[model samples]
Target: MTNPYTTAPMPPQPPLRPAPKWARKRYVLPALALAFFIGIGAGGASGDDAKTTAAKPKSASPRPTVTVTTTAEAREPEPAPTVTATKTVKVTATPAPDTGTVADDDSGADVYYANCSEAHAAGAAPVHRGEPGYASHLDRDNDGVGCDS
Candidate 1:
């Protein structure tokens, strides 16, 4: 007899058994796939005769056509008006007086600036080599222009 105050030892568990070969995923999946393919093939074969008997060509009706007509009236072009008049008046030409500015000089050498500061003060900073007030001393980089800064 077991003592009421003492607990009994648990029995050893049974060893695990492997799944059956037919019940494994590898075998069962392929078997189910084969059965599914067979079922589809049987169903398609039995429906072939019904499909062939029920298939009938539909009758075609002629599509409607549309016609459009347009007309334009022809008219002769109108002749332009002709008028002639003659008048004579005497005219006099006057020469403009020269203001004698640097714009009148072809060389533009008359326009002068002593330094870049003077050129900037005159609001003519970036003077090109050909333009007025451009000097080599003002252009430290000697890139043809003067007072670039």
Candidate 2:
């Protein structure tokens, strides 16, 4: 006795799956768009870029004017200083008159006794003409009257 259907074997079959649509178009279009935008942006930034400038100084307007007033007082004149002068004088005093002159009959003694003796004896008269009693005594020089000399 012998078994049949053992002469050959069949190959194994692989599993099946779904495929993506436009997959290749997807990466190529995006990469090209990215490169185009980047080149345009870089070219615009590099060549003939716009520059900003500062404004110029303008002329200034004229300033307003102001006025001021002041008052002054007149000066007064200065007064002159006062000055005084002093002088020395020599004064001579005369004696009282007697009854006789220096050379009269009674002589100078009569004049002394009549007019001067009373005050002379009391030590009241000065000794000489220039002295206090000189005026009270007789005319010693025989000039004109008692004490006149």
Candidate 3:
């Protein structure tokens, strides 16, 4: 009896077919993008055409012509006017007196703080020049405000 392991020869395998060439996304994406841009351009051109067609004049009319004429006459020259009289003038100015006190709308000039930290602690972080607890040291830029930081 033939051996159980021995089997009929397997039919020859069919030849493998080559894979179909696929369009790469790198090329296809750019082509699609170019097509989209061209479509948009075409749409814009068509829209402009529609507007121009709608705005076109129904009939053409001849433009009117203008004619200009000029005439000149001879005339005598006029005499120059003479000056009647002249006078001299003098002016004087005086310096105004200096005022020691500053005029401020807010009345907190007496309040003083040693530093920005002290002012911040006292709930007065930003102090203007005329406001209370404002000092030159607290304002680094000297913009008339203190404890700005």
Best by lDDT: 1
lDDT of 3 by residue, 46-117 (tens): 667789988987797899999898888878888789888633323222222446766464355456676666
lDDT of 3 at 14: 94
Question: How far is each candidate from the true structure, as Cα RMSD in Å?
Answer: 17.7, 38.8, 27.8
Clashing pairs counted in every model: 0, 4, 0
Best by TM-score: 1
> What TM-score number comes out for model 1?
0.28
lDDT of each: 0.73, 0.51, 0.71
Clashing pairs in 3: none
Residue 6's lDDT within candidate 3 is 75
Q: Against the hidden reference, what TM-scores do the models get?
A: 0.28, 0.19, 0.28
Query: TM-score of the candidate numbered 2?
Result: 0.19
Regions more than 4 Å wrong, model 3: 1-107
Clashes of 3: 0
**By TM-score, is 2 or 3 better?**
3
Clashes of 1: 0
